[model samples]
Target: MLKDFKPTLFILARFILIYLILLAIYQYFLNYYSGTGLDPYSKMITEQVRYIQNYLGYQTQLYNDIKNEQVYFYVRNDYPTRMVEGCNAISVMILFIAFVFAFYKGLKIFTFIIISLILLYILNLLRITGLNIIMTDYKEYGKIAHDFIFPSIIYGGVVILWLIWIKHFVLKDKVSNELKDKI
Candidate 1:
């Protein structure tokens, strides 16, 4: 029988890769004026959504009225934003590591990985856009969605990508056959 694929390398490489990528992006953002240029031009989208919500006078006083519940690493509005930020960090690293693993393991590097990365980033922007809309439309549920639910959706996507890479490219029957022989 084939051994289960361990996420240790995937996880570790993801951490290092994402840290470096974030450092580069942070430096770029610092050197470049306006946070507007950073993401999929979503600043405008978020702004428009927020403006529309405000203009509609749909005052759902849910978020404003609730007293924040205390939890580790959670302080009021900080948790949702933090979760989104963490997802960004994790997603970048996961993509980078997956690409490297695929390439090193003799898979089509640029064709599969580059396209997947682009799609991942696009989907990420969509997630952010949806989160922005939700945060505005349902102020009361913002914390629940952003802090827990939204991050899960994004992480779920990353897991699915990893599974695809493993099933089709990385840990294929050939790999399992070799491992069985060696064992």
Candidate 2:
């Protein structure tokens, strides 16, 4: 039993090692950017959200409040949402890219990574805009929407993409298909 599982375990180990290294490198860059005064990732997310709001004909404004030292923006009046590091979706992009790197390191991996990152960023901006709209109109559902519903959509999308990669790249490969036959 253990002999048969060795390859799977080894693959798992490699996944962990590579994923952590990639995630660390990503975090380092994110931190480096944030350390320079304004966090570009979060700032972009805020701006993108603002753009979406404005596109929809909402009155939007971006500003910094010095007393409390928070950088945020307003939408649909003075309704504000602060742009923080977590809202940037860097963490999700890191995880998405890590899974791709771990599963298959083919020539097309770079293309897949770029496409996945773009899709995730777009999804996140749409999520934020939808949440802002929700919070603006139906305050009672805001907490549930932000805390549970929206995260499920983003993370669930990642899970689906991972499964697609596995189906198309991993299981379709000759060696992995042989392993699947044995298992």
Candidate 3:
């Protein structure tokens, strides 16, 4: 009975362990910079967003409200977009990483994980940039765009990446093994 469930149990345990460990490290990182304005990663992300806005010809200013631990981006002196720790997408990245590590295959997996993380980061940046634009020009639709559309884009990207990994790496290996056994 136990033997029958061994693989399933192992995968579940691995996923939980990796997710918790990564989450703990992330929490410690946030706590370490609790008193400061914004954590370094979040600040970096905000800075990149500022640059993107500027390049897109929007007059942009970044105000770091250290007291509240929030960064606000002002565009063309209009409504500002508030950026917090969650805006940086570290949590999403952590989830993506945990799923990848849970289904660890081989050394090649590291490359895939790195590439996926980079793509996820870029996707987040674009998401934030688009959100800023929406908030600035179409204030009425900001709520729906932020609350529903943007999150779906990021999470959808993660799901697609997970599917690619399982299909290309995990399932491929299983199929190959079955083929070998048949022959």
Candidate 4:
């Protein structure tokens, strides 16, 4: 009875460890940057998205909103949409890191993670840019695009990256051996 629970417990422990560490890092950034004169990372994300939008000849306007004397970032491409903290992709990246770390600890995990995160950040930028473009170009589909498709691109890419990590880096021999022992 206890033996069967071991594998589940191992998985849970790995997941929790990864999650807490990543969450701590995320929370640190959130708190450290919250009450400052500026949030450098959030501004970077907003600027990157705006640069891409501008490169594609979509004029964008960026401004800050202050509530309780704390600054919030926002961008507009015709219609205004606030880029409020969550839109910056840090949370999604944190979740991605946690998920990737949970599954396998094969050699080069950090290498793969760093490269994957860079790619994911680019994809997230594209997702942000695409959503704004959709708002401008495909007005009729704007709701569904915002609510469904663009997010799917970022999250779906995470799933694909997870699969790639498992298939390419993690050894089949080790996995099968673990499976054999667990079973």
Give the lDDT of residue 18 in candidate 4: 85
Which residue pairs collide in model 3, if any?
none
The TM-score measured for candidate 2 stands at 0.84
Better of 2 and 4 by TM-score: 2
TM-score of 1: 0.51
Tell how far residue 122 is off in model 4, in angstroms. Answer: 0.3
Candidate 3 lDDT at 92 equals 91
Kindly list the per-residue Cα lDDT of model 4 for residues 135-178, writing each as its tens digit. 77777887898889988888898889888877866556567889
Candidate closest to the true structure, highest TM-score? 3
- Cα shift from native, residue 69, model 3 (Å): 0.5
Q: Write the per-residue lDDT of candidate 2 for residues 1-183, one digit (tens) a residue.
A: 999999778777777887798788877876576535446666677777888888887767887543443456676566646666677677887777766777765788888778878888899898888888788778899899989998998998789888878878777786776988999
Question: What local lDDT score does residue 168 receive in model 3, on the 0 to 100 scale?
Answer: 94
**Best to worst by TM-score, what's the order?**
3, 2, 4, 1
Which portions of model 2 miss their true places by more than 4 Å? 34-38, 65-70, 175-183
- Which segments of model 1 are wrong by more than 4 Å? 1-103, 176-183
RMSD of each: 9.6, 3.4, 0.9, 3.8
TM-score of every model versus the real structure: 0.51, 0.84, 0.97, 0.82
Candidate 2 global Cα RMSD = 3.4
Q: List the residue pairs that clash in candidate 4.
A: none
